[model samples]
Target chain A: MTGTLFLQTLVDGLILGGIFSLSAVGFSLIFGVLGVVNLSHGIFVLLGAYLGLALKEAWGIDPLMAIPLVFGALFVLGGLVQITLVSGAVRRGSLMSSLLITFGVSLMLRDLIILVFGPDVQSLSSSWLFDTFRIGGVIVDGARASGLIASLLSLGLLSYVLYRSKVGRAMRATAQQDFAAGLCGIDVKKIYAMTFGVSAGFAGVSGIIVGLINPFTPFDDTHWTLNAFVTVVLGGVGSPVGALLGGLMLGGISTFSSQYVGSLYPNVFIFGALLLMLIVRPNGLLGNAYKGSV
Target chain B: MNKQISRRTALGLLGATMTSATALRAMPARAATDGVIRFGGSLGMSGRYAETGLNIRHGYETAIKYINEEKGGVQIAGKTYSLELGIVDDASDPARATTLIQRQVDEGVDFFLGSYGSNVVLPCAGITEAAGKVTVQVGGSADQIFTQGYENIFGFFPRASRAWVTSIEFFKSIEPKPKTVSVMATNSAFSKLNAQAAAAGCKEIGLEVLDVLELPEQVTDSSSALATLRARTPDILITTTVDQNSLVIARQMIATETNVPLLYQFLGPQLPAYRESLGAKADGVVMQLPWDESLEFTDPTFGDTQSYIDYYNATNDRPFSYHTVGASSCITTYIEAMKAAGSVDPLAVRDALDAIDIVTAFGPVNFTEDGDGDPILMGAKIGQVQGGEIKVVYPENLRTAETLYPTPTWAEKG
Candidate 1:
């Protein structure tokens, strides 16, 4: 029975890790290539959830089915924000300017969410996503399973785009030397904007997964943003594989700490683990995926 | 005819004067401050508590509207003055709430309306107490708020877990009596006190206490905790958290197939989203409400519980909730105390409140001199979701339907 509980804990951690990896991958990518520390990353995630909710409520579109629509919507939105707000800060060349502007942008977006969504807790769901299955002595539910599958696929897509696609090489080149990439006839600013858009698109997709598992409100953005930063630091900066490792490790630490030590003790453990990892590997386990970026 | 005017004639003028917008707030009395009773507070107008805080404001507004527009405001020392509610959005931040309350105190506001959540209430209540002004709080019910010996902070909510203890008596009365209970709670101050009190209640009632697991603040997953509860297979599962957190716990429970005979929640089931979230699976889940339609407490302002509900239904901007009732009761309590004290002086009103014991639209209010947790006014009657509607099912006389005792298994609910 104890072994089963431990195994169930492990399984839950893995599911949660998939979600965390998906959520942070966008933040990691932006942090890797753009080096902007996009604080509004969580807003993009929440925007996705709200859009998914709108689609589901209006037309009975399942959250999974609403993903492409949400992704498209947020990609455009994220690009505009980068071009207008973040790009200004980036051009200013002040170290803290981008962070400050993004933070400001995040606050405005949060208010915008409240204005539209009416400041109430809302959720997205589907009748088909309500299944519970037991394999051996472990239990896994449909919402989380679906979330995991969605997250992995999204992460896989992101990985393929970053490592295999021509646009991927351009992004890496821009991350290495913006001046050199511009001289190579690559539009550095455009690459940065696309990376930001892709990052936002992934964040939105994760929001759909998150909404599947739990209810959310406009105020919940802070939690997602902080968790993404921690995941990036723990796993390795700016890589999908690092995000997965960090997310999975964070999930394991969270669930096991909750089960064994105490439920409220996970934050303490999470921070302690983060501090230890920072000491051991300043750039994270796999190290900065794009080392020359920052 | 009164005040040299017929009541119907006065109402006609008022009806014509009232604009189409009933989203009216900061209601300034048409009859100016012959004797003004100033009320103000910082509310969670823009964060997680934005909706709830605004509902509380509507509750205050509803009472003030009925009193000023209908009853011609408060009659104090042979002079009548209308109630004015001045509020600022604190965004549910504790430090901001504290600062906003102190600012109101500096501005010489007479009375304070409490913020919605425990986090905000704890800090702001101290500032009000220090200013020697009385704050009638609605939502924050952590027992320490009262036990800390602040005479100025009056709470509508009793001890955080008073209902949990009371519900035990109801639970024990059911046949096929439950012998074991498991508790899950968030780590919020209110929920911590709540879960502890509930565990104690189960034990005192001779039920075997399984585990009382605490979920983290902003918990993303509770699989291990739910799995533990499922393993123990307690007959009853009591979850303590705000409505949002409750959704997460319930979704996980359903997803994991953690079947407890009875699923009892502190906050979620009263909400429509609870039913919408769980669909048919919400059936048989139980909680208690501080105010309900069946309550017959006569209110001086709204006339009775039903009348207040009528006013709330007619004019409130937010959805129907016990919170609206509690917020109205905050205003009603102030008005009654003012009438008793017969003066607009803050100290006089404070003394009146300390000595007053009256049943408002919400329920009975009898504050112990120490102002520590009082169960008499906690007044949360047990309710269960039956046929997709929440119905009272405890304390025999208040039972709208029989208890879904030994609630059906998850598959059985399906």
Candidate 2:
């Protein structure tokens, strides 16, 4: 590839990496804190995008301006779902039951989305940020650049919340050992609900960013969920910083593989890398972020 | 061609014929008691292609109304048989689609209608081709589908390879005509084939082929490809993409300012969702389509283009699309072939389909033995989305609007 082409791919990879990182941090959090794989995570993201789209079309609200609305709606729904379904599923059969329940809920919500929005692909357009900025020979589109900024800000805020707050301390304690944390005066169930809510809300925030950069359909939920899972696996299962490392790695691998290797080989390369990572370091590059010694 | 039957009644008749399969198998696809001829197959009604599948269903249902009530049914050897549709939702699953076709074949439904996209049609047609059943479809355009020597599978649409091959004349007419071109194709079987064919066509017509950018299957960005375009800056950019890919790539192209003088998407711009997403940005972006509403063609089936549009609009909640007509022509061709052969026999009708040239609501119909459609009819017209609507911009005589040559770049439009 030419030097210019290489530089462009590198820039594109970083932007894509930002999107992947923000979209997955919540998934990593949920997986670590609850030990319940949230298969329905992707739908929350889609719900945010759809909500943004509806707001845009119905009232001429910009997608960027509607992120808070989308985030609030999904956060409440996620908390309620954690209390009602996820907690009940965990009670019935632990992690496997939770997994199945999340999968079923994902399918149900996916169908609901189709019914509400139709199965057509949709993209978000912003009146405020639709321009192409150029730096010498490099071209940066406004949609992607805006998405990258949102992702970074969201990630930075999430880090502050996870490390510098009492709630963050409780969440980490519960993630490490819920029984011990409960004995130590942490309200384990409430913490779980809050973690799930935060994870889901962050997922929704990322979804709006995704909609800004890429065209999405209801069926794309599974793809987003899977991507987040891979990000966690490649970086470290439970850390925002790990999700960032993993997402950027994935973004680079995807772009380089598609550009230099072949268009058809990105998935193969990604999965192969995932398998290799698992074999080399089961705990991941930085290891679990929250889990402490039992 | 005067009588009108309730389209709902035709659907009920379609359902009614399912129970009379014992008589259907004993006879040659004809139910003696109800005079109902069953046409069944699997379509993607609830999956990735659900929208196109629903449109095809409307096309099939509408054609059934015309065949049974207006055209007085399929006349063959002094007997008439009303058409009944027996379709199942395959949900775009290749294995399930083939299995459904096989199930219908086992149950003795001889005539088959095709589903949308090559993925569904490829396997479904394989089942019908093996059963010695005739499948008249509009979706299977990949050259491998035809070159597979599947004689029973007839594509009533443009072959994937001939997409740009058919556009040669149109390109020749461009003002300050293009000399260099680039291609960006997604990872679908049809898209890849169409892109390769476009490159070949460019070479044939002496246009310099800068590059063929095969986009990642789940592409969110195209920076590397855009950079190549920036460096090369080809006069024209040809992209082979479907609705989703088109929207994503088009958005990316606009953002990256990877603007060319002309940009053409093979399929995406014609879809409603893509048009809605792009809005006025869709204008000047030319696309290739098998049928447009403006073609001045007349046939006994739907009279002409205007009537077809009217009937479609009267029934469907949405505006008319080209695929609806393509779907309707499948039934029209089967009826016309059976009438021409004067027999309801599967082999006889298939042979007659190979020979007869008849006009339908969609256009002309004549399937080559290799299962290709009438080339003259399936020209895949060049359509430029003008004034927020697609209009024919080529083949001079069928031109509905003037060709917006040297399509405005993204920067120019902005």
Top of the candidates by TM-score: 1
Residue-wise lDDT of candidate 1 within B1-414, one digit each (tens)?
386578778887888667533425434554344766779898898887886887787888888888888887788888888887898899889888888888898998879988989889888888888889888878687766877888888887666766465578777887888899998888777788888888998899899988888888666788878878877889888988888888888888888888888898988888777788888889999897776776688888888998888777887656867888888888988888888988878889888888878888778887766553357565578888888888888878777899887777766776
Model 1 bad stretches (over 4 Å): A287-294, B1-33, B161-163, B372-374
Task: Please estimate how well model 2 matches the true structure, expressed as its whole-model Cα lDDT.
Answer: 0.81
- What DockQ do you compute for every candidate structure? 0.64, 0.55
> Which TM-score value belongs to model 2?
0.91
Model 1 chain B poorest ten-residue lDDT run: B19-28
The residue-by-residue lDDT of candidate 1 on A1-294, one tens digit each, is 999998999999999889999999889888888877888888888989999999988898988999999999888888899998899876776659879998998999998988888787888878866687889999888998888888888888887887899999899888788889999999989998998899899999999999988888898898889899889999887788889998998888989998888888989999999999889887887648344432
Worst 10 residues of 1 chain A by lDDT: A285-294
In terms of lDDT, the best-performing candidate is 1
lDDT of each: 0.83, 0.81
Model 1 residue B217 distance off true place after TM-score fit, in angstroms:
2.0
lDDT of 1 at B198: 88
Worst 10 residues of 2 chain B by lDDT: B25-34
Q: Name the Cα RMSD for model 2.
A: 6.8
